[model samples]
Target chain A: MTAASATVLITHPTGLHARPAVKLTKLAKTFEAAIRLRPDGQEGWIDAKSIVKVMGLKLRSGSRLELAAEGVDAPDAVAQLRALVERNFDENV
Target chain B: MTADTVGIVIVSHSPKVAEGAADMVRAMVGDGVRVACCGGNPAGGLGTDAARILAAIEEVWSPQGVAVLVDLGGAEMNAEMAIEMLDEGRGAQVRVCNAPIVEGAVVAATEASAGSSLDAVCAAAEELCQ
Candidate 1:
């Protein structure tokens, strides 16, 4: 199986705060793929489906997001999550 | 939505603390997980009430099971009583986790939001103690 990956920039004005973090984790859970995320310089990847781990990352606005997923829906998971961040999660900012 | 998630109850000596913890859980976990809180005595003082805890469990009752968080020994005792008081099979599925109220509830609810099992959610709360 091939792993899908993408690098995107977070443009959320407040970064991945409560709502955005919750949204990200909840969306990750909807997919069958195992998705992981890390910041540009971070050496460890965190489970995107876990709210605690995702919030622990403390990602900020303008941060470079590195995402990768491997599983049945790897490609779709990476694409959708990338779009979500790029669109600022539909937040009016 | 809540059917697949484990339920959570926050038990504390202070009503404000219980409500505050529940607020944090909701803010972080969203509506995917069901959570209820009970604190303060009937006299409006610092104490845990078994009746209130029982009601809180009922409020967030889930077939998937319920995880209860408490602040101190007294709160734990009362929470256990409340869980035992649950009639029928509901009591069997309810658990009083040995973890801090605020942090445990938050982590447990977070795992529950992901459709984790009752044991998994309880384990997540216990992991915080380590």
Candidate 2:
């Protein structure tokens, strides 16, 4: 199985709140890859596709997160998620 | 009015609570689900109004049906009464779900956005109880 990963900074002023968490979960569900995310130095990763889990992370602005995906579409999943974070989840930074 | 997308209504004694919950659901589901909020009494006090609840149900009514989430107590009774006030055929299309308002609305909206049936939406919302 292919694996891909990226470390992204949370740029949204409010961080990974409910709205962005929902957007991330929705995007994660569109891929076949097993997506997981954790704080840059966190011990364990949580399923990125679960809104509840993602929101529970309570990532704050400027927090660094590591997004990892493993599967046939791992590379694409990682790239898309990275872009989403870089874009500030399409919300005003 | 999508054939398979069930709508949702949130009922609470406080208008702010109902509207805020609806906002949260909309944030999760985007524009894909129909969500309405009905709160406060006819006198504009902190109580659930059956007429207001009925109007909310109608506002989001779809052939697929609607699920009502109430914030406990008289809110549930008002929701049920609102459903009963509808024509028999239409009333049968609505359900007063025994679920927490905020969490239930979020779950129900997400499920309905996926084109789930009324029963499926209610079941999804009810899962929050577990």
Task: State every prediction's TM-score relative to the real structure.
Answer: 0.88, 0.75
After aligning candidate 1 to the native by TM-score, how far in Å is the CA of B125 from where it should be? 3.4
| Residue pair clashes in candidate 1 | none
Among these predictions, the greatest TM-score belongs to: 1
Candidate 1's displacement at residue A51, Å, is 2.2
Colliding pairs, model 2: none
> lDDT per model, in order?
0.87, 0.86
- Docking quality tier of candidate 1? acceptable
Output the lDDT of residue B90, model 2: 97
> Candidate 2: lDDT over CA atoms?
0.86
Tell me the TM-score of candidate 2's A chain. Answer: 0.97
